[model samples]
Target chain A: MRQTREFANPPVVLGYATIAGPKEGEGPLAAYFDKVINNLYYYEDTWEKAEQKMFLEVAEMALQKASVKKEEVDFFLAGDLLNQIISANFAAKSLGIPFFGLYNACATFYEGLILGAMLIAGGFAKKVLVGVSSHYATVERQYRNPTEQGVQKTPTSQWTVTGAAAVVLGDGEGKIKIPRVTVGKALDYDMFDPSDMGGAMVPAAFDTLLVHFKETGLVYDYYDLMLTGDLARFGQQILVKLLQENNINFGQRLNDCGIMIYRPEQQVNAGGSGTACSALVTAGYVFNELSQGKIHKFLGIGTGALLSQVTTQQGMAIPVIAHAVAFESY
Target chain B: MAIDKNEYQKTVEKIKPRPPVLKNCVLAFLMGGFVCFLGEVLFHFLRGYGLSEKDSYTVVSVVFILISAVLTGTGIYDDLVRIFGAGLIVPITGFANSMVSPALEHKQEGLVLGVGAKLFTVAGPVVIYGILSSLIVAIILRGLGKL
Candidate 1:
């Protein structure tokens, strides 16, 4: 909340796990997920339960992959798009780890990582588990409509990715290290229509990108890749135009996790969204890219719409935020 | 840099992708007409059973409503609505689906507060306005001695 932070001792990304539903598993990043569950239900009776199960599954997988016992993990920082963040809290209940349930809509990914990295870098915790999950059906039931309701999505609308992703940030010999974080202020540009979150969130992303560059003296090409989550198809175009107007060009190095998570023909109108959208891509796709040396430095930006069904109905402008975390390979 | 909200909205509107309105309209028209055609055929079949014209009309509507309810229960009505656009909407199927969908979805919250109450969440407005306007028209017609 104060300013952009640069960790004197960067926290290592020890291990990560991604659990995807059938739709996300069928995505282009299918192979990267540790577990691509073919069922949306994830063997649970309800979509909400399924999301909680997916959250816990990813947390357990990440802890195991980090080669650390569940008892060794100090804190669980997680959240989702659900009301009151029940998915993260219920999963945390089963995890038995101290938890902080965040509510940044989709930006919980970056917020969690920012705080988790701080906890590790500031010597507050040795191993902090940062995770987030979201489900299409659960989100629909909560924010939009009934899951099975046949209301067709408009072209600008983004589909919520049904998945969960977790990364264990700890002091360890891991390949990826978190070096800096630029926190986003909740910004709104009077953009209405909750369906067009991409439009509403462009300003937040623009501000964070501007501030991050200003704070770190990092130019557009400083990182090998920069990603904004939930900007989707239409959103990135708007962002690109805005950046060009500001005389900032990221070239082809910039991409969005929303676009990476799904193929064009996947019926995802404006690519993918939800809290899991970015985390799944970062933990699963981008993680592989980093480990494979395809990209050395990656800046992952979490862009979120902070609109509830009630607020949206009450004729309020959709407030949005974007947080950036700079990850580099040691 | 501080943002000019108006300028940002213009940028968003410029790049925003619009829904395929013409295509949706075409599909809706064709499918909507097809559903009515089926109803007409059902009417003829019911009329052939020696039922009165009024009874035949009622039976045809009931048949369509029942089919919609069953499809909604099987979780197939919404899929049809997606492809058909407003095709299913103009007919009674959309109403039936709207009623059934919320009830089924909220059943987990239990019957009283969930299913029973939310049964008409979508259709409630339709019923309220539909009857209210109808009653107003009836009163006007009665005053004019038309009914």
Candidate 2:
């Protein structure tokens, strides 16, 4: 069965904004960020509150940038790395918009995009706001260790992006149009290591990309860019090799958000991972390029490792998923 | 999936870069030695102040604990661990850090349930297992009735 939904009328990306942490702000894509918090606390008492604040602010920023208001948005869809998605839930509480909390791990941002677009195209809603955020301190304390703990990180581990990204999608003309969404399925290759998120997530990315290609009957060159969410450098290498073995050459078109966000010297080990990694890149860099007609058709895939602290602690294998949203510019 | 878990794991293992074992060992050795050396220096310094031998050891330990707590609070201990690896982890300072960091992290949760309960989140296991193993060893020595 085809996994992609071809929209009769595409939902346009009306406005988008990105708020990144200080570390991400110092990275190469710093210019694309809408705001960068100078400190990890972001002036909040706790890291959790800091994340919630970012989520709320980024959603508001997207609306303000689009010349839209909270009342005008038909639905708000959001998620994050926090437990019970407190970031999105608290943000929604303040946003006061009709909300749908979604979770697909790091792929949550694309899931939001997909659902928002679907709502718009299906006449369920005229305008939808989608957002996702992740904080390094919040995730580290929950998933790994205390932020101040002296545990050493493995080389394959990724740094979580301490930021948030939100987009305003409307039915009318927008900067870019999302025409299709290929929702991915959770797949596990018995990847159990929580540290090597790229290892756990690569299969899902590979599976989704292949499904999108086969279901849509489109080749790799059909899009100007086929971006993977946050596979980092190692996962990217393995993915490139896997694609080659399958006789599908992505050439130079395959780019990973994790690898693009930070330089190797940033000491992030592998690279950036987390929901915000892909969201920030797509909402800021890719959206800008699409809006400017730099590349007409683009396929952005958000890859996620759907593993939790409980699952990791219990020695459970990581199941991963990737969702792809294809955008076209007139 | 085209590849099973084992095959995929092999692919990952092949692509994943190996951490520098030798370099890490050398660094860990130097750092761990430095930490121990500091402890010894503090012990001698305390003894020179006319503190009892037992009191000097106690003072050295307390001083190290204080330093580690300060470092962890200032957010420098984790970075030092990244470079030094087990050097920071195998000492009393590490124990102090493990305790202090969790307390600091959970301070927002309030005193009783948050800081007090979570203060031993990391070190709790160490204390439990440490005592268990030591008890086992002591029992074996008693069974031997010597040494």
Candidate 3:
């Protein structure tokens, strides 16, 4: 129906937990994260295994925070950037919950959230766990070059966040509630350069945002914050221009998770990316703000550049997507 | 949405973030030069330790390669390259990085199939061409000598 869905009964955010690596832990939102592992390996032999461990940890942490047992959770909705989403699969295996693995690249967190919220709102499940994880080393090797390769990074390249975040969605009342969700269509603006993912995904972010506003009949300033998943500096600039062209300006309320994750001097280049970028930011920063009544209403738009090595190698344009969820403080 | 190629290109050109050429170049120069300087220091050190000039040069090259591989394993070489840009690549350390990086990356696939198979992904062409060109030059020299 090319429209946003407003749930009759909005799902409540029972609890959320964020765990990050050393670099992200050192960033601005370090205090917001629940657990920050200084070691990248995190007692695991490989980076992939470490990411898997993080997913499991965050999921368990979220469940514990919500006072829900693993058996009480109806389904685990999770995703990651790795091939076959091995991290999520392994974590799901350990959690012993019915699993629905998703792949929306960087926007996977929101994808999980929307689906989980729907399950709860539709009365299909009492509780659903939404989780996402991405490791810097793992994503670096899978998406681009290995860390040891020492390949010179383009200034436009965004650093993949080595972190994981999980949220427990329930049918009960809570401090924060997800009222509506806007699912975006896959749009390709003929962006080919993978190194410039922010540039590639900005148009999709704008498109979904515009549609969300139109379908929901919500003004640009309706929410206290309009957060894009991982647009970084360059994508944020492009998004502002795109919004301006449409005669809608979010002004100071607009901030990207990518740009917010790291400081300017951190040398993260364009800033943080991966599924965990927005996941951790929302779970830690935004969730806290909403709980404290600092932000009454907020919109989190997760943007993803659906590019694989195979698609890029085949000379296909990068397909981008953005999904937004409206969260309000109860 | 599909846009015309020319229109898409124009938008990309207008929006794409420009790379900082001057800063990157300076970093590259300093880093690359620093690596070369370290190599020079190693050469002199080897010579001081009683090695001949030629032997010292060889020893320095080997040492630089070993140091680069070790640094890559510890995950320090990548950071150096990140800051130095092309500077680190111009040194002998870059070659070591190119060889070891792929091997380490593919290590998850196991030793033989992963590391052994993909070991030369980057350095393979260089090694093959090097041996081929040297062989060709030697044959040409022999032919000229006969003549």
Candidate 4:
């Protein structure tokens, strides 16, 4: 196994697609998404089923954009925040692709990208598709109270992003390349509050980012942008402070997908989260920048707080992880 | 890894968003008072319509609970709760919402097992204690020759 942090044969990003629900579509980066369903249900009976439909749709859309047939793709690495990752499972079943379902909560998109890039980099697969999705209603019901419960959320509580995004990595020529990935370790700082996920996840994000910078020997200014998955406003603040303490700063360039995806007046508490948070932002906004030659190099770090309702109720600390994937526009 | 517990807690406290307790309390109080006022209006209206005082109170409570349940079903009560905070919850309407919301959410599992079984997941203890307390009060009243 190639245990190195940087990939020798960086995989090329052949094509990518992102789809979001109405709320996300209303966000500032809505125009970047390939498809934005006006309704959360999107013609499905249940929110879970709708999310599954979105996953399948975005997967197909990504493959179509790449001009690759479903059979041409060797593997589909996908995940979602749902229990048992049923959305990805059902989508995989419908797509009839060899599936590897992952669970890193909101950081699932980067996890999928890391694994998919590795599969392509190691010559295990010529073409691999990475997909991730999260529906606000589905995740809200699963993690917290029911949507209809009328439970008042705290200011720190983030809105779960409702969307799906997919990226196809292949050996062929592409506009962008993923050269390195830094997988994060699970770090639990004894933060037991499930509501303040951004606070819980900052330490893990800092640890992974520190490791990435050390391994790559790259400075903060090397990349034009350093993006975290779903740290939102509070997580971004904590991350900045943590990095400053370590004497590594990426001022102004260190933005978060959670804070970028939504408008301030959208009232999304601490901005957006869910697997779709980074997925949509990266595949839509970041990919658009890379394609438009606006950004030369970028580091996308996906952060996730691996906490469940049961774990939280049992008084267990929330363990957080962050995986970083380096991309360059060529 | 050996994380400094004190340092971690300090960082968390520094960065974590503090809940606006005063604002929440004010909103909760106003909303809770409004709900009660609405109940009072209904109670008076019922009593004026020839219903006994006890019957009018019961009718008012039933109407509020019904409204709350419907609001919960239509996904409007949650919006109200978001703005009102504990205001909607402290009232009997909040109790009604609590009962109906979980049942509605679990309705996909089928009627008997999903809705019926998990119906009282939140309100079950309240019902049991409510009945027990009421029974004990009744017994005490009878023993004191006040029943």
Candidate with top DockQ is 2
lDDT of 2 by residue, A149-267 (tens): 99888899999998999999999787699988999989888888888999789999998998888888886689989899999999999999888888888888899999999988999
Displacement of the residue B96 alpha carbon in candidate 1, Å: 0.5
| Model 4 per-residue lDDT at A267 | 91
* Candidate 3 collision pairs: none
List clashing residue pairs in candidate 4.
A150-B78
lDDT of 4 by residue, A1-66 (tens): 122266677899999999998999899998999999998889988888899999999999999998
Candidate 1, B4-93: lDDT as tens digits: 888887888888888899999999999889989999999998888899999998888888888888988898888888788899887887
Q: What does the lDDT read for residue A128 in candidate 4?
A: 95
DockQ of each: 0.69, 0.83, 0.54, 0.70
Q: After superposition, which runs of candidate 3 have C-alpha atoms over 4 Å from their true positions?
A: B1-9, B30-60, B105-108, B129-147
lDDT of each model, Cα atoms only?
Answer: 0.89, 0.92, 0.90, 0.89
> Chain A TM-score for each candidate, in the given order?
0.98, 0.98, 0.99, 0.98
Q: How much of the true A–B contact set does each candidate keep?
A: 0.62, 0.91, 0.70, 0.81
Q: What is the TM-score ranking, best to worst?
A: 2, 1, 4, 3
lDDT by residue for model 2 (B58-127), tens: 8888999999999999999999999999999999999999999989998889999899999988789999
Instruction: Name the TM-score of candidate 4.
Output: 0.95
TM for every model, in the order presented, reads 0.97, 0.97, 0.91, 0.95
